[model samples]
Target: MPDIYRALGDSTRRRILSMLKQGNKTQKEIVDAFDISQPAIKKHLTILLEERMISERLNGKYRIYSLNLSILQTAYQEMLHYIGELLDEQLISLKNYVEKGEFRDEDD
Candidate 1:
């Protein structure tokens, strides 16, 4: 799932995934939607494909890519774990601050 996360870490790749989430698209179709070159889009697609986040199929002369939802569950679980840990730490700090009366009420 590291690969999936890494691939998605880029803004461009994330945008591509957002588009894919709407529906399947050919590499050409994906490129046409943006001002970037076809090769650039293909590179992003390659990363997503390598990470198993998307799958491609050959149709005639066109290669179509579709989102793979299977890996999403694992990725989501990993992200959830990290977020939970962060929240836990922050909550503990907030509790300690409250106990010390370090925070002032909004009214003054």
Candidate 2:
């Protein structure tokens, strides 16, 4: 969970992840898409790799990166659970308000 939060904490990493989702890309290609330095891009990749959110393959001299998708599943599941709970709470609140005559009219 900490890794998920850390991986999502940086905008550069998020951009890299989004790009990788489209297709695999070499280190040079990822760096070219950003205005930052190569070393900076490498740092972001390192964090993402440690979190297992992305994977890399050595293609001769180039390291190609792609999204792992599995580890990212935890983050997505967490978000879904949170959203479901919020919606349930709101529905209960609406029900209570209606029952208590705090949000009702005779128009119906």
Off by over 4 Å in 2: 1-5, 103-108
lDDT for each residue of candidate 2 in 1-108, tens digit (9 for 90 to 100): 626878989999999999998999999999999999999999999999998899999989999999887778877898788889999999999989888888646796
Which residue window of length 10 is worst by lDDT in model 1? 1-10
In model 2, what are the clashing residue pairs, if there are any? none
How high is the CA lDDT of each candidate model?
A: 0.87, 0.90
User: Residue 26 of model 1: what lDDT?
Assistant: 86
RMSD of each: 2.7, 2.8
TM-score (all chains, Cα) for each model: 0.78, 0.75
Residue-by-residue lDDT tens digits, candidate 1, 1-108: 546568878988898889999999988889988888888888988888888888999999999988888787787787898989999999999999999998889999
TM-score of 2: 0.75
What lDDT score is found at residue 103 in candidate 2? 60
Off by over 4 Å in 1: 100-108
